[model samples]
Target: MAKAICILTGNHTAFGVVFFKSDANGCVTVKGEFTGLTPGKHGLHIHSFGDLTNGWISAGPHYNPNNEMHGAPQDEKRHAGDLGNVDVNEDGLAKLEMEIQHFHLTGIHSVIGRTLMIHQNEDDLGRAGNEESLATGNAGVGVAWGVIGICQSNISEKALEEKSNQ
Candidate 1:
């Protein structure tokens, strides 16, 4: 019913595109691809703020409106914004596709106007024994980030007419 898109960019010329859409089944579907990162796993999460003035730092901590500890996307105790990680291939390209019920467009946990971050290292899934694991998931510095925004639907009259004719 609604859609959102982000143009991700960050350290070492890292960049990617992501789309957040409200699926027909009342769930959110995330689909996108990223590149210009190291060949390995990297953290991915939705941040608190949408402002990118100071890059990733300005986005604030992971969106934890529910006051939950950091954990894997599949973990029942993880933050609402915890999206786990994106695995880059040998050429530093990552294609991401997932459906998560952690957030919604109409709720206190809504991700609208927030930002998504891509960390420099793999997220340990908050299973590690480190002190910050419960906070940052042991994910290293943010290498790339993007602001999430509601998508605008603009249809051309010509396209509408063509569709009607079909």
Candidate 2:
């Protein structure tokens, strides 16, 4: 499997680690552990850029290569970055795990080097009856953000060399 990881950062104490593991079929499992958030739902998305020079704003918009509308992760016509929301418990901790097909960790649709962001509000999944909802799910400002990077691969160098020679 291909693997990637992100270490979140923000202005506040909210922080976390997100992991992405993908199989050869392009199915990806997203898992994350977060803390120091409000006891409620927060939007989670993948922005187009990894830039953090100017903070979250510099990350660009959602990773919508197809220019699709904002919606849930399972939506057929949604942006690739529309990952929906994560719920925080009363103790300000959230454990998230989901399987997504919109993007993978490797190949053409890979999200590596992009920005993973935690928003300040719950995503309406494009049902909020407003233009912003269609565009951004009204997911407010980003609270935490991180850049996706490749983790150590399980495939050995010999296996990779042999595969390349095939």
Which candidate number maximizes lDDT?
Answer: 2
RMSD of 2: 6.9
lDDT score of residue 48 within candidate 2: 96
Runs off by more than 4 Å, candidate 2: 155-166
Q: Each candidate's TM vs. the true structure?
A: 0.89, 0.91
What is each predicted model's overall lDDT from 0 to 1? Answer: 0.84, 0.88
Can you write out model 2's per-residue Cα lDDT over 1-166, one digit (the tens) per residue?
8888888889678887887888777889888888888889999999999999999999999999898989999889999999999999999899999999889887778999999999999999999999999988998998999999997788543443344336
User: Which pairs clash (backbone N, Cα, C closer than 3 Å) in model 1?
Assistant: none
